[model samples]
Target: MDMIADFDLTAHNTFGLKSTADRAVLIDDAAMLPELAKASAETGRPLKILGGGSNVVLAERLDAIVAIMRIAGRSVNQQTTDATIVTAGAGENWHDFVVWTVDQGIAGLENLAGIPGTVGAAPIQNIGAYGAQLSDFFQSLTAYDLKTGTIETFDAEACRFAYRQSAFKSEPGRYVILTVTLALPRTWKAKRDYAGLDRLPEDATARAVLDHVVALRASKLPDWRVLGNAGSFFHNPVVSAEAARAFEDAPQYPQVDGTVKLSAGWLIEQSGLKGFRLGPAGTYDRHALVLVNHGGATARDIAALATHIRDKVRIRYGVDLVQEPIVL
Candidate 1:
């Protein structure tokens, strides 16, 4: 397998941090991964499977061999009376794929519009937004088992999906996602259970929901292409119902099982950290949930800022906020 040595990863990661991998190989096809895996073992170098890099925070130079997953394609595998199964390659841009499904008159992914990442990374993160999650429509996925170099399939149950998590995430480096197959509804239905989406008109269609979600995301989130960020920095902290009662004025969403999910952004803003800046790394002025790289911030700068934010929130509200991005 051909590889590039000392490859720069500034443009690859969404945060735009200046870091380099010891060596890198672009796997445009899943068939090439077995050889790549063998090469990694022979070279005695660890392998890091990098997707869109939207949910990663690169801390420093990596000594491992970076395997960039560039596998690409998408097609309608089959269609039933009520649902259509759409399969996409791991490299397909997630937002573009969502728009494609909507254009094909397939619903169920509209509320997850505007999310940045590759489709392969979706199941790993169980990516969610508004009211819809990828698991809600996930049918199955094909992945490569790095250890055995064998291809494997996982149903939704096998994926073990939870809120912003999956088996792939819990066991990193064990499997490399190759393709994702989702069963979308033929009969369109708008998901409006989440806050911004809940405010939409009752007659909202799938397209309308997509547009509203896109608009809402664009308004709230800083464009990572312009201003470096990894979307939401922290997961909305879930606490016990009794514990949530202490913060009566805080915005809280009660789950089906009676747990309460508190808004991390609200807690940060309430702590007076909104627009807080230390050089290029700071909490975003418009949305306190986001940590931004203004221009020339490094991973250390961002980490320090995140640590400060987490500490302040923990001391103030007794709620520990966990970061959403994978810190590499």
Candidate 2:
């Protein structure tokens, strides 16, 4: 473990918020975790894990010890008649991993291409895009229990995945993911139920789906490297059928459980907050769902802007908009 005191985290998070941690450790190996956890306990500072920093909002200064997960590896773990089990290190870039699967003729992850963050972070939020989610392909994962100081394996059922939620998210900082194992289907069929994907042909290949998803995301979301932003700022609010009927014009997707999923971006746009700016933080002009840092925006600025949007949307539509990014 490589340790740095007063570590700068401005570049660590995709939001590009200027932030620092009292101490940060580059965790390249899982074996380093127990020792690092011990030190953190001794110092009385909480150990916080960060991976790729894509889906997080960082405060100006954290009083905790940040563990930057960088453990890396990838392999085809097993081959079965129905599916191929692939394993990837927690620190592996998500998009790159998707590309690797396509290059290896593996399918099922193509619909999730272009999502930013590390593989380990995917299950935490059950990261999804287009017509598929991480839980759909997830077989199992290896994680280190911070509370128990033991390496543990969790299968799909154990993950308790819901839309943009998981057990890991419910109990944050209790486990540090080490590897994600996915079961990619051997006989793949195109998943084109989502809007942009629906335009794809019936016989689209995994590479084609990946390229299309990438293009679609590029056209919709601003590159985090170029413009500081977490991709989707809020989860699409799932409301009761009667509650959803109040917004007659808003796009709605009926859930299996009879709840209606409303577009958060539409709510923000209708609330007249899209392209609205407060100091350096604002909703992206192109996509209302995304909150962006114009330049030099602090975490406070982002939080204030988020609060403004939430309040406005709630007052206008009577639906609460929950933020997608984990605020630290």
Candidate 3:
């Protein structure tokens, strides 16, 4: 473990917010976690695990011992008649990992091609896109439990995955994910029900689906490197069937639980906040769902803009808008 005091974290997070940590510990190997845990315990400071920093809002200064996950490895764990089990180190880039699977002729993860974050962060947020979620292909994961100072494995059930939520997210800073395993189907099937993908042929190949999803995302969301934004800043609020009837103009998808998932983007656009700016933070003009940092923006700026968007949406639609990113 490599430790640096008063570490600059502006580059660590996608939002490009100016921030720093009292101490930043680089964890390039899983084995380093035990030693780091011991050091953290000795110092009496809790461990804060930071992955790719794609889905997080960082404060101006973090007073904790921030462990930057950089563990790296990937392998084909096992093969069964129906599926292929693969494993990736927690620090592996999520999009690159998805591309690797596709290059290997694996098909289940194609619909989730363009999501930003690390493999470990995927299960934490139950990351999803284009009608598919990480939970759909999950097998299990290895994590270092900070509370008990032991390594543990959690299956899908233990993960308790909901839309954009997981047990890790519910209990933040408790587990440091070391690796993620996914079970991809041997037989290929195209999932083309989502909007942009609906135009694809019923028998589209996994590569075709992946290419389309990537293109769609590229066209919609700005590159975080260029724009400094977290993609899809808010969750698509699920409302009761009766309550959804109030917004006839909003796009609504009926859920299995008899609720309706309304488009958060549509609501924001309807509320006239698209391309809206407040200080250095604003809503992206192209996609209202994304919140961007227009240079020199801080956590407080993003928070204020988020609060503004939420208040407007709630006032107009009587529905609450919850942020998707974890604020640290």
Candidate 4:
């Protein structure tokens, strides 16, 4: 792979902001990792692993050498009476992995379909959607210990998964996930417990769940290629039950479990920032939480808009909305 100096990362990220990377390397093969590591050692630059670039904001130029994981492989290892065991390469597209599983007649990951990113980054964030998460179907994985330069296997519990957080995310740059092993069912088991999808038919199978989720998302979210967005911009701010109760009398609050789950979109809209534009970066009119790059948006513009919205919400609702995407 050619090592380019001062590459523009705006095109690499989903936000489409113009930012530079001091150096970047795309690892299409795992065998080249040693060489890449050696080069980094000589250069004294830590490598930043990036995937589909769906969930990050380019805040500043990346000073370190960026290592884009491109390792690709997929295999089904076991076919039991009720389930099938499969493993996906780190560089495989996350949505493509879902499609592959569905094509193999496997169940359990359909609800998480259409999330933009890579298979390797999936476990890193324990990405969740429509009542399902990457952990639900995950069995284990082999991640390379960046320091030891050795691959090690980690099972489900070792991941320390919770909501939208994971061990990989907590300890960034420590491991490079090589392959993900998943346990899927041959039979249908839909996570239809979440709202909207709970109306599935009596015989609703995995395929049905997949179709329904895709249709639901098609209605709610805008296509990133056309409109330029990185899905949800902010995570649902989780608050205490007492905080939720205070809003119980309010018309805009919803309680989830014992915590108060407030929709960041609703808050953004309430703050009258929907369709609000700042130098070509605007909040999607249909979905307030989704920030769109309306052609020629700079990284500075998007960052300003995010900060503006965040400040507005805190001032108005007394709740601080945290940005979901990793801001570099």
Candidate 5:
């Protein structure tokens, strides 16, 4: 196990910040994981399981061994009743799979098209947008339990998914997802819950819905690969119906149950932080929620900017917008 030492992790993460990993190895297949487990135990080192590296910010240098999941495959099964059980290897590109599934006429994942990250990390965060979440399509996953060093199956019930939160995140580094099983119907009606999606012209096809979402996201989210961003820096706050009623005159989006969801981006914009800057890190002019690094910036620089926004929102509105990505 000749793991590369002090490897640059800037390119590996979406934020594109300069960072290093003391140990890094690409695990291309599950069959090779047992060997990795043995190697980790031999060295008594904790392993860092990195996937597409979109939803994480490495703030400091780390000495942990990095096991990059590289498993990739797709088995589109018409074997079931008008249902497509598309199982993807953990390392498979997420948006690419979404596009492929849509091409195959699968309907479940159409709303989630264009999200970054690998298949393995999907269920861990229960990634969702545009009236659809990964949990809505997720059936099961095969994970390697680091504690027992054995492969195990986790069903949807066991995932403990909440709004942008999951069991995998709650119990960090316990399960390394290897493959994910998704259930998509060959033909199904789309979910038009959000007013923005509802406002789409009538007779919107699956592709039309996807196109609208992609355009909406593109209009705001800067390309992280080129501009150094991690999509939305904060998760939208969900306040209780009564608490939200206190801000009846204030803007809010209708949410599930009795909850009202306020937009974090709107809050940030209203706080006069749009186009604001701190060192090399700053808020995007078009989208306040997105924090971008203008060419040169450090991890601390971005973190500081995020902290500033959080503080301003808390002070101005008494609402705390939590950071979305994992900050190391």
Candidate 6:
């Protein structure tokens, strides 16, 4: 692996903020991880692991040894009577992998279509869209432990999966994910519990679900290539039942555990920040949750816009809006 100095990260992040990494390297094989760890220790500089750069906000220059995970491979690891286990490298595009699984007749990942990011980052956030989360189909994952300099595997329970959280996220930069294995059901059933999906027929196929999800996401979220956004900028605030009662007319989805998941977009829109713009940074006109860089925007511009929205939402409602992207 060749190390590059002062690597420009403008194109590396979906936000398209212009920034530079002090040092960066790309590793295509897991065998090189030990050496990479050794080099990291020898350099005395902090190390930062990066994937497809979909879920990060590079507000400042990364002053560390940035190791871009590019390890790539995919295959059916096992096929049972009821399920199939498929493994993909960390660098594999998540949406592409989902499409591949559905095309192979595996049905568990259809509802997660059109999500942007790498396979390795999925479990980090326990990425969920529609009515499905990565934790639902996650079998296991292999990661390179920074402290031990050894490769380790973690099962679903070991991952400590929760809403938009996992052990990896709880302890960031501690492990470099190498591969992810998903358990897809052989006997398929469409998951149409989510709002738009509920309109589909009960016998809708995996392809049909995939098509609907793709179309739905396209209509809601701006394409990162065209608008430069990290999809949803904030998580849907889950509040107590009593607190949710105050906003009776607000769109609320009650959780199985009695908590109420209030729509962040609805909150922002209600706060009157929809289509709110300052400089080149602004919330997408179509979706208030999406903060976009409308060309010639600086990292500070986006940060300020986000802060403004958060303050307005917090003032209007008692709930604090938590940003979804990792600002680094």
Per-candidate TM vs. native? 0.96, 0.98, 0.97, 0.92, 0.93, 0.96
lDDT of 6 by residue, 1-328 (tens): 6889999888888888777888889878888877777777898877787887888988567878888888899999899887899999999999999999888877889999998889989999999989899999889999989988888999999999999989988788889899999888887789998889998899999999999999999888888988899889999999999889998989988999999999999999999989999999999999999999988776788889988999999899877999998876
Quality of model 6 by C-alpha lDDT: 0.89
lDDT of 4 by residue, 1-328 (tens): 5888897787788877777888988887777777777887898887888898888877557887887778899998998897789999999998888888888777778998888889998988799998778887889999888889988999989999987788887788889888999888676656778878989976787788888988899999888878877889998888887776655534343445666677878888989999898888999988899999998776688889999999999998898988878766
Per-residue lDDT over 273-328 for candidate 5, one digit per residue giving the tens place of the 0 to 100 score: 99999998899888998888886677898889988999999998899889888865
Give candidate 1's TM-score.
0.96
Error of 3 at 51 (Å): 0.9
Q: Which regions of candidate 5 fall more than 4 Å away from where they truly are? A: 192-196, 199-201
Q: What tens digits encode model 2's per-residue C-alpha lDDT throughout 1-328?
A: 5679999999999989999999999888999998899989999999999998888999999989999988889999899999999999999999999999999998899999999889989999999989799999989999999989999999999999999999998898999999999999898899998998888999999999999999999999999899999988999999999888888998999999999999999999999988999999999998999999999999999999999999998787777889889987
Q: What is the lDDT of residue 97 in candidate 2?
A: 95
Which residues of candidate 2, in runs, are more than 4 Å off? none
**lDDT tens digits, residue span 68-161, model 1:** 8889999988999979999999999999999998888777888888999899899988999887899989999999999888999999999999
User: What's model 3's lDDT at 142?
Assistant: 95
C-alpha lDDT of residue 195 in model 6: 88
> What are the RMSD figures for all models against the true structure?
1.3, 0.9, 1.2, 2.2, 1.9, 1.3
Instruction: Give the range where candidate 3 is weakest over 10 consecutive residues by summed lDDT.
Output: 29-38
Q: How many clashes in candidate 5?
A: 0
For residues 101-213, what per-residue lDDT tens digits would candidate 3 score against the true structure?
99988879999998988998899889999999999999999998878878999999999999999999878888999999999989877998888998999989899999999
Error of 2 at 266 (Å): 0.4
How far is 19's C-alpha from truth in model 6 (Å)?
1.4
Which ranges in model 3 have alpha carbons more than 4 Å from their true place?
none
- Of 1 and 5, the candidate ranking higher by lDDT: 1
